[model samples]
Target: MSHLLIPALFFLVILVGAFIQPAAARKPYASIPVKNLFSYIEILPPGSRVLLAWDYDPATQGEMQLLAQPILRHLQRKRVQIVNVSLRPFGPNVAADAQTMKQWPMSAQAAAPTEFGFIPGESAALRALTHSPVIASNQPRTSARTSGLRPTDTLAAFDLVIEFSASFANSQEWVEQVASRTQKPFIVAASGAVAPLLRPYQQTHQIRVLLSGYPDALAYESLLQHNGPAHRQRTAQTLALGLLLILVLIAATRSLLRR
Candidate 1:
């Protein structure tokens, strides 16, 4: 038997599986962070400003879509001022959301939460945003003729900056760039793969809230007595991980037996 064929088959299988749009993306579950976001908005006065950061790229979007969508919806519903920012190099896009990024609208019920746009790196951009007079000085996602909104406008006006990270910066970067510079409140939502690394920051108050993927999202949903996409995606995600572990174990066992 050819040993290479086994791993080759795995890739082939995953590619085919990708086309199927696994059960998770269709129905995602809400985690604790979602609920916490819901509650935070509940207590805040109407028309408050919030800076939303998408820290990861396409690789992590599927797992966190459940968290992102509802978070956007809740903010829109609460009439909160939203300033969308992305740290990921290719993480910004607009497709006619409930609230268009075209113009900031606070009272549109059917309105989707508005997006600001992508800045640059975490350190330089965040620092500039905290102090600069104009935001979106360098628009990575939009073209020159499209929208000319400055991220600086949103950053200066917003009260909070929530970083949805993937341990890309260890939470220290946000504290340094946004928190320390402007002394504004910032929160972090990290993937389970990197949540442990962020624990110290949460413990020390370097970051305000910590929302780990899947399970944490579910907890938040429970807190609000609301259920959403994160739950379903997490279920499928859970199943997928379980299958991968089993496959890994079997392969290890077979290799040991052969040895």
Candidate 2:
């Protein structure tokens, strides 16, 4: 039974940690990338149009939604007009579900996001968006929300471009097809699995800000003065890691005593 004790305790710790909620107010770790992202959004003038690309699917929705919630709130507070578009087929549904889950509060003066639906053809579609925003969108051109967008106006029409990316290639396509050509401030909130691959673009200044993983997400919430889902998950992760470290030390001490 002694041999099985540590493994049992470890699993117990994980089980407990998974349900841990945010307790005390922990200061979020300082992160430049997250801060830069906040600043980019902070500077946008009211009534400025922003192109928000939801590029992730249900597979990555868990992490992606946490990242998007705070961003959507910040944009609302800034009172920018958001135009949502997606590359993946399921992207629009995911975006809608996230909004529904939060029931995101909006001021009367703040306009809700105008959905442009899914744009197919990936890189080709993105390239087309650079030439004409309305032409690339799935939304009807006759709709009141998009009617204001003139044919001559391209990606440059939006003051900022933000993408919640699950795949590095999707973000890369945006950089090459749109950001480079339009010279707009582009930000990407990518999944941790793919964030490292997207860092080079940030380093090269092609991406204005790159936020990924729990750390950046928590840091961003800190910047916004909001304690969100990331905070709770991060707390749980810390607890599990701490418990594992204690168990390891205990096991090592017991072995030394016997020897």
Candidate 3:
């Protein structure tokens, strides 16, 4: 019973922390990459065109969506012309769901993104986009038509390119095919599992901003001055980790005293 006390207490603490509200006044530590991402979006003109690539599927949607929501909100606030595209088949549906959940007001709905839906060729499609932005006529459209994406428009036409990627290969393809060719300001919000592999691109300056994992998401939300889901999740995570550390220290002390 004595040996089980620490584990039981730690579990109870985590359970309670999940139900508690995060302290609104607590400031999140924003990293340099997160700050750079915020600056890149902040300077965009109201009508600037942005290419938003949703490259993740439902398997990684849980993390990808949390990272995407705040960034989407920031883009909407900037009032940029967003052109949505995807390399993954399930990506278009996921992007559509995110847009629906974060729908703009009736007045601003006219300015919502133009969905190009899923582009099937992956790396080959990205290479094509460098010269032309048009998707195949057979591809399904998910949203209302917008004006900027024309048959003649190329990848360079967009002011910025942002990709929320789950796969290292897909993100790498974008870096190699589109971003390197167009020389556009490329931003990638990748999953924690894939982010370390992408660091080389960021180091090469091919990716202007790279945001990954819950810490960066929480930091980005802090920079936006919005307490969203990341904040609540981070609070719970911190509580659980801190409690575990304390329990470990207590157990070590007890063992030392017995010795």
Residue 75 shift from truth in candidate 3, angstroms? 0.1
- Which residue runs does candidate 2 get wrong by more than 4 Å? 1-24, 107-109, 144-147, 235-259
Ranking by TM-score: 2, 3, 1
lDDT of 2 at 32: 84
lDDT of each: 0.59, 0.81, 0.81
TM-score of each: 0.63, 0.80, 0.79
Candidate ranking (lDDT, best to worst): 2, 3, 1
Model 1 error, position 233 (Å) = 4.0
What C-alpha lDDT, on a 0 to 100 scale, does residue 197 get in candidate 1? Answer: 84
Candidate 1 vs candidate 3, TM-score winner: 3
The residue-level lDDT of candidate 2 at 258 comes to 60
Q: What are the per-residue Cα lDDT tens digits for candidate 1 across 1-259?
A: 4566567557756654554554435443555545555667677566677777777666776565545555555566576656566766655652223133223243365323355466666677767767652444464434322223343453446666777776557356777667665655567777777678877777777776677766666655544444556555555665777677657656755765565
RMSD of each: 10.5, 6.0, 5.9
What's the TM for model 2?
Answer: 0.80
Q: Which residue runs of candidate 3 sit more than 4 Å off their true CA positions?
A: 1-22, 103-110, 135-145, 235-259
How accurate locally is residue 218 in candidate 1, as Cα lDDT from 0 to 100? 60
